[model samples]
Target: MRAVACVLFILSLVWDSVRADNSISSLKMAAASWEGELPCKEWNCECAFKQRGCCCAATDLQEVEDQIFHKVMDLSRRVFQLGDTILEVLGGIRVAFTASMSHKKTCFGPFTRSTPIPYNLLTFNHGSGYNPALGIFTAPRPGLYSFSFSVYSKVQGEGEKMYYKVQLMRNGEAVVSTWEDNREDSEDSSSQTVLLSLEQGGQVYVQLLSGRQLCGNIEGLNTFSGALIYPTLT
Candidate 1:
């Protein structure tokens, strides 16, 4: 019985030795199969037989990180551009104007048709929105605005009819009017103030009605003015 037990133990050792030799042979064959082929296409890698997948994983991870970095940089650039655009829009929102008829003592006419009264004297034009030559105030932006106009006249002789009609015009339409048609006063003056909601490029001005004459404007009292109350942002 003792001899038989010793023999069984020896057989077990032999079986273990065979299994170890077969495992080594399998590993050698796998190495030989990948001897000429690269485990990773872009980088050199020394991989063990069981760890061959480790080579391409690191390269792939690096590529993914590079892509993520570029995406972040692009997003940052877009945000900066948007900020600059907002600043430019805010900087352009200013409007104010004050102007009057020419400083020289003069009379504005009785024309066959209604004519725009040219205010050639510029007191202040913050945004260059008022044009003296054209006798027009162009709105620089959408906003509420205040406008005022004054008309003054003196008849050639006492008891003569003081006949005049002047209107504040918006886009060729009358918004307000001031006139002196009665003979009670030899010289007369009138003024009007109005609040207007304007869009970009809207125009406003003063006009003399047809067959109406204004005189005795020596003091630059005949004036037109406007200012932006507030901007409407959307």
Candidate 2:
């Protein structure tokens, strides 16, 4: 029992001496690194003398963590922006409309200048892009669209002029035209269909050229229709 106690006492002394040496070495290193500066004076850090530059180590770790946190926040903001763009694209899925002149036995025009035709009857307006008042169909999104229009006119006499010139227009520019100036037929109708790639807010409509007239039962016979094939998100 006495020999065991002696061994334990010697072990305790050796451990104390080692601990004292480690503590002195740590203090020396700290003093050498910050010779004339106050501990943690220039940094948000916990000061410690038990390990060399422990305060600076903590401050560097905090700076790295802050950088990582800022990067995460920026990525999150980008993700939300992408999600909003996707929702907006999906919002205008299927767009289509069919419109015609009001139900009446009337005459359209033999105007001095070119005029846009107001197809005021709305048979279908899936996306509400067509404006009966404005006589235009504005594209709600960029896409490939198919547009069709028909023109009809009738004259009282066989020798009378059945003159009519109708055009499909895109943003004030004429795309396609149909006309019948001969008196061979007392009444006639012509239709045109076109496929157009359009950007958002692009406008399309039917227009009558100058010095032309559409007279007679030209109600539902004069028609304009369009449908979106697919979106081009660019």
Candidate 3:
């Protein structure tokens, strides 16, 4: 009876070991399927199980990391290409206008001014004379632009001086304006700079105002100035 019991006990132990092995083998096969690899053979179950578990885990992680890397690379490339395109467009659409006095006249003084005033400052020339009612300059292209102007004037008397006004306009709207009052028998100069986002076919203009004559040297009192437009990164 004891011998028979020993044999049965040994058989039970073997059966349990086989069952545990079968469970491990089934788990490894499932893992292998997840990894898209070949299934384990019955004879090489141990090695296949180990390899499938490790390969499936590593492959999942690698796929996630690769997806993230590709997304980031695509975004970076798009931004770089957009920057290049903006630079190319800006390089093509800058415009500038310079203004100089071509004629000067005095009503009731020994005025001794010369025509074609010196190019001592900056200015702009529109198709028509400057009108205060119209305030903006249209752009020739849609872009980021900068505007600048300078005013040159001669001081006459308390009432008789030259007043010059500089303005930045976009689509007939005044974005900025500056004025110089030179009525105090002293030389006067003023300037202004502005940044604007302008559309194509916009216009800009400058206006001048003259004060009454005074008791100073009003003769040779003319001015020159202009506007420059260029593209900017900001």
The number of the candidate with the highest lDDT is 2
Candidate 3: list runs displaced more than 4 Å: 1-91, 106-137, 156-164, 181-183, 209-234
Could you report the Cα RMSD, in angstroms, for every candidate shown?
Answer: 14.6, 13.3, 13.0
Q: Quantify all predictions' global Cα lDDT against the true fold.
A: 0.77, 0.80, 0.45
lDDT of 3 at 87: 79
**Best candidate, TM-score:** 2
For 16-112, candidate 3 gives per-residue lDDT tens digits of 4456565645544543344222322222334433553332234456787999999999999999999999977754553544443333343222223
- Cα lDDT tens digits, model 2, 106-200, are 57888999999999999989889899997899998899999999988899666898998999999889999999988788999989999999999
Model 1 misses residue 76 by how many Å? 26
lDDT of 3: 0.45
TM-score of 1: 0.60
TM-score of each: 0.60, 0.60, 0.36
lDDT of 1 by residue, 82-133 (tens): 9999988765776888888875455678899999988998989978899999
